[model samples]
Target: MLKTAILVSAMGAGLMVATVASAADAALGQKTFETTCVACHGAKGVSVVPIYPNLAGQKEQYLVEQLKAFHDGTRVNPIMQPMAAALSDADIANVAAYLSSLKPE
Candidate 1:
């Protein structure tokens, strides 16, 4: 039916909008990383410190989940917990997208 078709089209449009917003936020994420994460994770997502895990080439979903866990105390890490605590959901998504898009060395 035309009504069903319209609903599907609206859903697809909504997805497209979300995709565009996420892409825009990825740029914001890079800035945030430079300001906050580069000290540990490096500019390319490779950590200069062996103790810090390299974030390059990670799955976006996994990164999002881990960040959420770190924020919520489901995963315990002194550093990450505090770091993630400062981030909003959008920030988490943005950073995860940016990190996951990188190629590992």
Candidate 2:
């Protein structure tokens, strides 16, 4: 019973840490977007060019899947394939979360 209590406490602490880390990831994503994505996607995930699709308010899961697809060559885009290749799974998730959190016009 003592061991069970200890395990439960440890699990709760781990969950808290995970939540904090996930929050940090969104911040990182925001920074990444400002530096890398703003050139095309604009500061708020709206595209400046008609050719580029706006990213704001999209579903997080949809962005994640599309990014993963670009990274994996399942989706073909000369620009995105190379860009997404540089992103890790965590970066992809973070960026998706940040973009999806924005309001669309």
Candidate 3:
């Protein structure tokens, strides 16, 4: 019985670690941003264009919510709607994580 308890505890801990690992990956986010967001948002989440918002150092939850809104058509924008539509939920989370990690200029 003690052995079974230990095994179950170990399995639970492994699952928790896996969950944490899968929650967000900033490196993956950077790759996606390079391919998708570099044009408007610049190299490090600072937008080159005056109209585009700077994403660096923004709150992660806010970024995630806005992106989801754009993806769902709740926050309509001609450019961002389509751009955000291409991202999955995981991609949004990762991107938000990456952007939030940056220091705003």
Which candidate should be chosen as best, given TM-score against the real structure? 3
**Between which residue pairs do clashes occur in model 3?**
none
The sequence of per-residue lDDT tens digits that candidate 1 reaches over residues 58-105 is 988789889999999999999999999998888888888888889987
lDDT at position 96, candidate 2: 85
Evaluated against the true structure, the overall lDDT of model 2 is 0.86
**TM-score of predicted structure 2:** 0.76
RMSD of each: 3.7, 5.0, 5.7
Candidate 3, residue 47: CA error in Å? 1.4
Which should have the higher TM-score, number 1 or number 3?
Answer: 3
lDDT for each candidate structure: 0.86, 0.86, 0.91
Candidate order by TM-score, decreasing, is 3, 1, 2
Instruction: Give a tens-digit lDDT track for model 2, residues 2-100.
Output: 999999999999998667545636777888878778888887899989999999999877888899999999999998898889888888888988988
TM-scores, all models, native as reference: 0.77, 0.76, 0.79
Give the range where candidate 3 is weakest over 10 consecutive residues by summed lDDT.
16-25
Flag regions of model 2 displaced more than 4 Å.
1-24
